[model samples]
Target: MNIINRAASILLLLVFFLAFFQNSVHGRPLLLSMSRPKPDDAALFARWLVSQSSWGVLNTIASDMGGAPFGNVVSFSDGLPDKGHGIPYFYLTTLDPTARNALKDQRSSFTISEYAIGTCGKKDPENPSCAKITLVGKLKVVTEDPKETTFAQTALFTKHPEMEGWPKSHDFQIYKLEIEEIFMINWFGGPKPLTVDQYLQAKMDSHTVIA
Candidate 1:
């Protein structure tokens, strides 16, 4: 009987470990430990994609490039793992063209692809089923208020630890996308018409289950 009990205990431990491994991706815990939200729920789905992503393409008008649109790959975070504000924050230096462009013209947009989160399975990134979002609005530096700047820096540094060690001479500052419009495509239909308010107000409750 003792032998049988010992075997059962070992089996239980194995099961628990398996469950933990399944919930984690790349050996890191997922934000909120939740799966992809249903595509029908545009607001929640958009928020989930933003929260899970660590990087995206930030677009700005390039005056030096003849007033053309320029896109740069950048790292960003919405907030800490559990508390996502759905507002993308970035750390940039004026030495980089992205920051310089933003200063010249605040008109900008940030795009995130669900493929980066690794939930799309074998689907191509451009596939309709694979979700993507573009936040269209102004990209402004967050420096006027000390409190807001501190909060933005914290939100950025927590997700991107390497930022803390960047050279100070580069003068890296905080910038955020003030989302005026949200365009998301997660399914066969056209892009979902999600307003900035709807995207910002979406809640990630217990019912927002994984795919």
Candidate 2:
């Protein structure tokens, strides 16, 4: 009878261990799951992309009168937030073709890439240290909205004081970008993305999970 009792106890212990192992393998811990960003990391990347002025590229898709799309590059200033959306705001003159095109058609996309100072040393194409972040979103041109125009103007002045004459030099207009999606590339040969949310939150929350 004692032997049978011992056997039953061992069977229950085995089942408990198997269940524990399965849960451990498949279940994400509450803390670990919460650490990941809730949604796309656009807000975080936008913040960093705005930090370095010359490190980013603004990609715009515009169309001619025939509706054929063309691309152009324009310097931009980061703008004030519209609640949660990462709306990158900037100013441009109506004389500028890109700005003119944007005024005509507010639907556009902008890409911001990480800039690397080219080195003379042997280059490694596969494993570069730099990371690139591109944000695809809609653009709007505003000429009459005083609040938005003022915000864009202030941001431009703060970033480029030399451009203080922008308001006076031409038919200055403000453009606001409403971010829809973001893409990021980390060329450091890691399986997981070098998450922008992780990067931004790291500045505030030093605790990070190590894989």
Best by TM-score: 1
Write the residue-wise lDDT of candidate 1 on 1-211 in tens digits. Answer: 9999999999999999888886674754454456777899899889889988888999999999999999999999888764678999999999999999999899999999888777889999999999999999999988788977877788888988889999999998899999898889999979998999989889866444554
lDDT of 1 at 31: 48
- Clash statistics: count for each candidate: 0, 0
Give per-residue CA lDDT, model 2, range 68-164, as digits (tens).
Answer: 5555665566532111123466666767666777667766666554343221135452343344556566677756778777777776666556677
Looking at model 1, residue 115 earns an lDDT score of: 83
What residue pairs clash in candidate 2, if any at all? none
Cα misplacement distance, residue 180 of candidate 2 (Å): 1.1
Scored by CA lDDT, what does every candidate get? 0.87, 0.52
| Highest lDDT model number | 1
Q: What ranges in model 1 sit over 4 Å off? A: 1-32, 206-211
Backbone steric clashes in candidate 2, count: 0
Query: Cα deviation in Å at residue 151, candidate 1?
Result: 2.1
Worst 10 residues of 2 by lDDT: 28-37
